[model samples]
Target: MKVIAFGASTSSTSINKALATYTAGLVDGAEVKVLNISDYSVPMFSEDLEKEIGQAEGAQAFLRDLADADALVISYAEHNGHYPAAFKNLFDWATRIDREVFKNKPAVYLSTSPGPGGAQSVLAAAVGSAPFFAGNVKASLSVPNFYDVFDLEAGQVKDDAVNAQLKEAVAKLA
Candidate 1:
């Protein structure tokens, strides 16, 4: 399967990015394409901007990437218990181009943070609103206390239990 994976944040050193990419790699025999949401930068969406620019190339390109994917893996980074502005902006623009931005592809949503809450609020929001955006959610996982559970240098999950749970979640796609 061609799995399109991305962290919904623009941070250069986003832990959510690491988690998303690493989790995507767990799918056996799958080709993973990692997307940097920052690369698909669109101006903050607004009716005025929509009228001025018609459509943003970044949003179009972002949609094209999703269109080619057989499945999706998105890890969200939370800011004040909500989506980071960078991600929300691109997402808003993409929605304008195609309300079904996920293209009805099966998806696994994930979130992580340095705290025990694990960014669950945003994950819940994503999962809750997924159907409206045509997201075919297969499963979801939240990895809390990221620095403790994941080994940055090894680029792998260190906790055996979390690793097992992660495997179980990804298995839904197969």
Candidate 2:
């Protein structure tokens, strides 16, 4: 099976990006393609802009990524209890192309942060809003106190309890 996974961020040193990459490896028997949001940059969504230049190549590429995916994995990085600006911009551009860009693909929704909440607010928001894009909800994993549970240097989960739950979630989605 093929799975398209991304951090929902563009930062080179993003913790959410790390979480997403680690989560992708948990899926059994799938090829995961990680996306770089920088590569899918679109101008701020505005009706004026849309009329001026039509959809940008970045928007089309973003839509194409979703179109080609069988399943998706995303680990959101919350900024003020919402999606990061980079991800929000990409989402806006993609939805401008089509509101249902995800096309009902099964998803392993996730979030992570340095705090204990693990971007729960944003993760919950994604769960609520994702269906509009035809996200077929499969599993959601929130990594709380990420610094304590995850080994950044080793790129693995150090907490056994968290790791076990992660395995269960991945199995359900996979």
Supply the TM-score for candidate 2: 0.95
lDDT at 71, model 2: 82
lDDT of 2 by residue, 41-146 (tens): 7888788998999987898998888777788888888999999887898788788888897888888889999998999999999999887888887889888999
Estimate, for each residue in 30-78, the C-alpha lDDT of model 1 and write its tens digit.
9999999989979878999899999999999999999999989999999
Best by lDDT: 1
Model 2 lDDT, residue 142, Cα: 85
Q: Which stretches of candidate 1 lie over 4 Å from their true place?
A: none
lDDT of each structure?
A: 0.93, 0.85
Q: How far is candidate 2 from the true structure (C-alpha RMSD, Å)?
A: 1.1
What local lDDT does model 1 show for residue 75? 96
Error of 1 at 123 (Å): 0.3
List clash counts for every candidate, in order: 0, 0
